[model samples]
Target: MTAPVAHAPVPLQLKRGGGDAFIVEHSEEFVTLASTAPSPPGSTVEATHQGDAGPTTVRVKVRGCRRDPLPDGREGFRIDGRFVSLTRADRAALFGSQSEADPGSTSET
Candidate 1:
């Protein structure tokens, strides 16, 4: 008789959303948008990059949901939110400064 094989678990990558775009993370659900945001407990909120197209107002809506286990066996929270009419300054603060040549490029440094 052949022995059963065990498969390795996959890792999760948290991505930052752009203007009007928000990220959502959950045990089994993950999504991204340009107008909505996520409000998970202990989750840090920030603005998007400058010159990006989005809303001015940002809204985060969090629900009482459990997050999936990380590769390191750490627990996380599930959240969601929204952003309205975000300006260049707002984007710069939230994300980062936009590139001089590429309007869409965001400088993390």
Candidate 2:
């Protein structure tokens, strides 16, 4: 299976009743993040990432959360989640205007 695309440790905002997080990696199916708060499994969280067109927002289902080290060597929470839903436009906004053949478009659920 292909691996998730690693992203720069850019801060991602969790809009509406959430905390900040940093993107660790992502694929069409899943996104991993580092945050200061724990998200219980089966919960949904909305996160926004800046793109070329504008800010792309997505809701993810929390699969797991564990203690981990952040990029800056501090203790943090590592969050694993799957995309709750995505549309054609959302895909474009998240990974640019690239085709599905691109590595960023791995799997979608």
Candidate 3:
């Protein structure tokens, strides 16, 4: 089996104005979010990750969502999504500077 992806929980806010959400894990291609409500799969949503550079917003396509237990013992939704679009600056802000081109997209021409 593959090792689990290690990630620190980071607070995230849905641009559409939802209750609240947090990123439980993330990678260049996908993110798993813990949300108060279920986000339907195939839906596109925007979320911003506050990094040292500033708030980096990314558009994501919801792949799946399932019920999960929250830290407070309340029911929460575990939302999985794939990155739909990300700019070079957004990649640098969210994952730090990359000497080479980002995966799935190249840096500025």
> Model 3, residue 37: what's the lDDT?
72
Candidate 1's TM-score reads 0.28
How high is each candidate's TM-score? Answer: 0.28, 0.72, 0.69
Higher-TM-score candidate among 1 and 3? 3
Global Cα RMSD, each model: 14.7, 4.4, 5.3
How many clashing pairs per prediction, in order?
Answer: 26, 0, 0
Please state the error at residue 71 of candidate 3 in Å.
5.2
Ranking by lDDT: 2, 3, 1
Q: Give the higher-TM-score candidate: 2 or 3.
A: 2
The better-scoring model by lDDT among 1 and 3 is: 3
> What lDDT score goes with residue 35 in model 2?
80
Off by over 4 Å in 2: 16-18, 99-109
| Model 1 per-residue lDDT tens digits across residues 50-70 | 224443333333323344433
Compared with the true structure, what per-residue lDDT tens digits does model 2 show for residues 1-109? 4579785675667886666778778876888888867788988878887776788787879999999887777777898988777777886666555454375554576
The positional error of residue 1 in candidate 3, measured at the CA in angstroms, is 14
Off by over 4 Å in 1: 1-59, 62-66, 69-73, 84-86, 98-109
Clashing pairs in 2: none
